[model samples]
Target: MPRYLSILTFAAALFCGACQNSHSDSKNQSSPEAGVKPAFVAQRGTPVLDGSGSDDLWEASDWLPINQIWAGTLPKPDDFSGRYKLAWDENNLYILAETTDDVLLDVHPQALEHFWDDDCLVVFLDEDASGGTHEFSYNAFAYHIALDGSVADVAPDSSFRYFNDHCLTRRIARDNVNTWEIAVRIFDGKQYKDEGDNVPMLLKKGKKMGFALAYCDNDHSAERESLVGNVPLPNTQNKQQWLNADVFGTLELR
Candidate 1:
């Protein structure tokens, strides 16, 4: 099983809960009676990772070994150049990824309006296998309707069954280095620890936080590179078609 990697790109937006109001008018696109598409559907970005990326940008030694690190099949050693970095602090999580493709250069001029097809990053967190509930997310826009929301085929009109009230604050900034930084801040009901009683128990019982991430450009059929960490994932001994982005010693919590 490939571990997915997540870039925290919405700490501020989550802390503010600003986009929730705008998405209010939007309802599930799939109709139960006739199965109609959504009113407004968006496109996804292309996949650009060829598996040749630098592992040095990560701080692996700091993370706990809940699971073993599994390697995914590389696209081809000499094929293409792709690199990414993962790091964290006591207050925020950071992910820096870069690829050699020029198609990802298209930028979204609007904020909180673009869907998955636009060069975007998705984050999965609070994975709970024992409880039979896993949360999948991308910034504040999430689809809890079905945890089966695979990043492989994310459609803008795809209707999610459950949309959590929680918000994910992120800030995605591009630099001249041809790299982008996705800083995410998770402000779940748990974040209000100062006001909650069970928070301490949740924190001490090894119920901290974890993440999975995937980046895509415009290619809907192209395979995407992903990373997973902290989540008790399934065994990936035979699945070679999908790449695992999750790495040990990669994520941290505040």
Candidate 2:
């Protein structure tokens, strides 16, 4: 991956803004995340970033079901189903998810538009596992990764921004299953800046952070049909993860 990919992504975002974004809070970080969140362990290893999940290192991890319903109705297996595996190294957090959706759609090519309404993977992250309302800040990020490999999130300014550089991804679909492999640079939400030069953190063992994973499924519709999460969430029927980081799950770099 290009080391300065974030710069390119940001530049492209600005260009898109020339063509034509609620995100309303700008704290560096927030209070400890709410609730006794689910704890997950990420084994230490580096896997090939290729969408093909053929690496032997993956065997060290287990597939965690991303089956919790956060919105809409529970989709049939043939319609939608997902599970993921996690692994990490000093530079990045790696996620491997296998999802089956009868059809994939990304109507909004513009990242700033209704990104969630399309078929995408939304990754919720709290840098320190200390969460609060980050709707308007970098204290956390809700990365909506589109099928085209573009990543979208609300910047501190509350404007839609593409964080494509933060996430290096690849997707391979075969036999109805789309395997997504993502390598995410762990940035301290408090230190990340859109116009300023920033660096990713060097992760270590036992490091804890708040995170959650989900998918928005839109099978030929004006909007998404279902939203599924990896962990059980409070107010299971209400989707608060986009605004509240307190509802996220905790992860430790093991």
Candidate 3:
């Protein structure tokens, strides 16, 4: 089996960003409430910056084998990928994800699939060694989860399925710029997917799981918080040249 590359401390420090702000209250990471069995994974790689340009925290496939990863993508020259930076401080883990597209994003999820063509960010976190899974998927518009087994997306507005009970928060910003970010906390299966053979897959209390990224066919259709940022956003016309996207954050486990 191939060895899993650990993230370097030098790179991880460079990507560190403060999460304190008016929006910080929306997502709180305090571990599973009391008796709740928190889902978790072992601390894998140290936080690091993965992208082109030494100062750029978002690392492109240039350094690592992008194509080698399942559903991963390589960015074209000039345009950039999403920015990802991770950090963990004793009690909680912090992760930030962002992407830049030459073609402005199409912020809407309707029909069978629409946002599938645009860019997106999919995150998975399992704090415990159990077989359960905690997923947070988002497009340029909104975000959703499969807490346990229920699937949520930005399309058709933010709604919940009867599958299971879990916590979810959606944030949309700079959608016109073709950029977006999400803050998540995986505390328990009840807060995520509530039923069925639900078990932690990629993460465990002591074991570790690899983080992944990819740019494939547009398979998203949902409503998003429109045109953010006062600055003029990138044009989404005929700019076939794909942009680069990366994630950054740290993982802290006990």
Candidate 4:
């Protein structure tokens, strides 16, 4: 079986909480019935793609926490914690994630096969905001940032066999803190062909996109112990939300 099908099959056994909010874009502005949908402020200048969090541009951005766990109750701050900030220029969207984990486990070298099983950061992006069942379309994008500073695009089916070279990622781990910086080219939804043939998507004020953030934690184990995300995921009753784009929160360009 294919990787996506295998994941979907596995997700069928997991359980999720009841959804609280109706699907609406404006509800994302404030606290919505579903949950708080954080917004990413646009930056006038691009920040350097270094893993260091010393950029002045990130100083003005808001840090959204990744708190919702897939199965167990929320963990304490001392055990594990993660927060991310976002900024976008004309060409690309920049993301910075600062995470604190007592144990950093990264054993997967091939991103397409086992990155999710390791300690990593995953971002889901629905570029067109269509909110359709994107099983076959290349409308959504999922970028996996491994703890080893390797990056891979996991969305749009084709990425299962191919790796994305356009997206840039960097990471720095010291003590219990891990900092990651990523730059993903914004592509025009109309002309997107594959992960390789990406055209820069021009984002303007008030433009909305389907967005979600997640963290995978593995403590020297064969599989991840917890999968935490910012938004409520689908098929949580039986499976993880790594493949579902429709459950993502709204992200408005500012």
Candidate maximizing TM-score: 2
Instruction: Kindly list the per-residue Cα lDDT of model 1 for residues 1-254, writing each as its tens digit.
Output: 22332223455557346445433422221111112211111112112222222334332322221121122332221221233444444333444444333344223323223333344444444322112122222212222111122222222344332222232222222332234444333445223322234221122122234344433333232332222122223453334212232311112333
Q: Residue pairs in steric clash, candidate 2? A: 25-136
Query: What range of 10 consecutive residues in model 2 has the weakest lDDT sum?
Result: 21-30
Please report, as a residue range, the 10-residue window in candidate 3 with the lowest summed lDDT. Answer: 224-233
Model 1 quality (TM-score): 0.35
List, residue by residue over 1-254, the lDDT tens digit for candidate 2.
58599889988998666533100111111112224467777999999999978898787667887777788878999889998889999999999999999998989876579899999998888989887988889888888999998999888788888998899899998988999999989898888889778889999999999888999999988979999887666666766654787877888999
TM-score of each: 0.35, 0.84, 0.35, 0.76
lDDT of 3: 0.30
| lDDT assessment of candidate 4 | 0.68
Q: lDDT of each structure?
A: 0.30, 0.84, 0.30, 0.68
- For model 4, residues 1-254, the per-residue Cα lDDT tens digits are 99999888767644222232243432433224444444444455588888887899888776776766664446577667888888877777778888888788878675467777788787777887766555445566666677665666644554453335546778888888988888877665557776355657776767778877788877767877778777655445336454656677777767
State the lDDT at 81 in candidate 3.
43
Per-candidate Cα RMSD to the true structure, in Å, reads: 20.4, 17.3, 17.0, 10.5
TM-score: model 3 vs. ground truth: 0.35
On lDDT, the leading prediction is 2
